[model samples]
Target: MDKRLSDYIKKVVTEHGVTSTLKMKLLLEVFLRQSIFVNTSLPPKHNKRFWPSLKDIYNHVAAQFLKLRDSCVDQKLVVEMVEEQRSLHKGERFYIRIKKDQEPGKFTDENFGMTKTEQSMKLVNILWEWPRMDLPINKGTGNIQGYNIATLFAKDIKTKLKEILELEEGDKRCYEPHWRHLQWIDRNDLTDHNVMNNSVKGMEERNKLFHEERWAEMSALVLEEFGLFKPKTIIGLFSPPGYYLSLKNCNNGKLMATLEDETGQRLNEGVRYFKDVLLVEARIIIASVVKNITYREAEELLYPLK
Candidate 1:
C-alpha cells in the first residue's frame, strides 16, 4: 500500500465523518490521479475505456489488497469473507441503505458496464469491505450475523497481535477486526446490457472458486493466530471429505490426515498419532454446511490445524 494513500485513509476514517464508501471513492480518485503520472505500469485502457473510473480503479485496488492480505496470512490458502466470519466473531449489526427501486441482481457493475472479471473482482472487494461474522451468542442455530467488530476481543490481545505484526493503529491488518460499512448507490443512468448476461454468468463461476480459496486461507490464519499448531496443542478438522483433498494438497505436509466418521469416531487406526485429527460434524449438510456452522464452531475446528 502507498504511504500517502494509507495516511489519507486514516485521516478520512478518523476525522472526515464521511461514510466508508465515499471515503474509499475519494481516496481512490486521489490515488489514481497521483499515481497515473508517476506509475507507468497501469494499463492505458481497460474494457475499451480510457482512464478507468474511480469505481474501476477502486475495485482493482481492493482485489489487490485482498490478495495481499491473504498472502500475508497464508500463501497457499485463499480466504474469503464467509470463511473469515467462521473464524472471527462479529461485533455489531447495522443496515446499509441501497437504492429502493434497484432490481435484485443489479449492482455497480451493471451500471458501469464492467466485464465479468471486473464484476467478480468487485464482489470479492465488497466481501472484505463489509465483512459479516458470527455473534458469540446463538452458537448452535448459526442464524446470528453482524457487520462489525466492536471491542469483541480483549484490548490486550489485539494490541499484542498488532505489535507482533508491527502495524500502527487503524491499519487494515488481518489480525485486527473492525467494521467498515459501505453505502451502495444505484446507477440507473448508464445502460449497457450487451455484455451483462455473460458478466452475470462469470460471477457465478467466480463466486464458487472464491469461497473454496477463502476457506483454505482463513483456516491457515486461524491456526497461526490461536497457536493451535503448537507441539502439545490439540487440533481438530471438521470438514467434508471433499475438503480433505484440498487441505492435504495445500497444507504443505503441516497437517497429518486421518479418517473419521460423523460421530467423531476414528476410522483409520486405533491410535490417533498426530496432534491434528479430522472429524466430521454430524449437523453439517453437504449442500448448506457453510451456512450451518457458527463462528465459534468454525474457530474450534480450524484453530488446531496450524
Candidate 2:
C-alpha cells in the first residue's frame, strides 16, 4: 500500500525522541491511510490502516504529542503566532490541531477560532509571564480562517503563564490577562483632575474586563477632595457604615467602584460587574490620597484576593 505519509510520520516521531509507540504509528496510519473529508468532490480513498486494536494507536499518538516542547519546536514561530492571535483581538477563542514540527498545522473549516466570551484568555504563554506582565485582548476583533500559528499562540500563552506563575490547576482566573495598563497610563498626563478621572475610568474598565484573579471584594477610597467624578453603572452590596458600592461614569468614561470602611462590611457590585467573584478578596490600588491639603498621590498597584 502507499505508506509514504505513515513512514514519514514515523520518522518524525523517532527524530523527536519517540522510539516505538503503536498508537502513534496507528494514528499516522489512520491520518494517512484513511479517507479524510476535504474537497468533498474528490473520490474517496477508503483504505483501512493496519491496526489490530484502538489502544495501540492511542498510546503511540499520546506519547508523541506529550513529548512536544520548546526544545522540539521553534520558539520564534510560536511567539509570532501568539502575538498575531492577540493582535486579532478575538479574545480567548482557539482551535486544537496536531502538526509536523517543521510545518504549519492543517486548518479545517470545522474548527471555530477562539472568542472573548469565555473571560479567560486560553492562548499559550499566559502563566510564563505571570507576576511580571499580562497581555490585554479586546473583544470582537476578527474571524480566524483556520488553525495554524494563531492556534499555537492561543495555546502557548496559557501554558507559559501557568508555568511562570506557578499556577495550580484549581487556581483559576476569570479575566483575560492584560498588559497594557502601564503603557496606556504612561501615555497620558495624570496631573489634570479630569485627565486623572478619565484614566481611572479606563483603569476600572481594564480591571473589570481583565483581572488576574477573581475577588469577591475590592475597594477604592474615592476622596471628595479630588473634585468631581461621576459614576458609570451603579450597584450596592453589604458594606460598612462609611462606604457604599458605586459604579460611575465620568466625562464619558465608565468605572466600577467598591467602597469599604472600618465597620468590616464589604461594598461592591454583587453580580452585575463580575461574572463569578467567589473568592474572599483581591485588590488593585489605582490612586490614593496621602498629603496635607494641597495634593494627592496616584499609582497602579496589584493585590491578591483572599
CA lDDT, every model vs. true structure: 0.29, 0.29
User: Candidate 2: where are CA atoms >4 Å away?
Assistant: 16-45, 50-56, 59-134, 137-306
Instruction: Please give, for residues 1-306, the per-residue lDDT of candidate 1 as tens digits.
Output: 445554554555334422224336545455656754466654453422434455544444444444433221222122233445655756644333334565422432131334544533333333232253331222122221221111212221233333322221242321122100000011111112112213555335324433433332322232223322111122222111111111111221212222223212211110121111111111111112334555334323322112
Among all candidates shown, the one with the greatest TM-score: 2
> How do the residues 1-306 of candidate 2 rate in per-residue lDDT, one tens digit apiece?
235444545456656444334334545544544554233442343443433233444444445544555432333335446758877977776543335553343222111222322212221122212442243432223112222222322442223322322211231222223212211112221123223224655456445433442111011111111112222222211111122222232221212212212111131222212111111011111111111111111222222111
Native-referenced Cα lDDT, model 2 = 0.29
Alpha-carbon shift of residue 122 in model 2 (angstroms): 6.5
At residue 153, candidate 2 shows an lDDT of 28
Report the Cα lDDT for candidate 1: 0.29
Tell me the number of clashing residue pairs for each predicted model: 4, 38
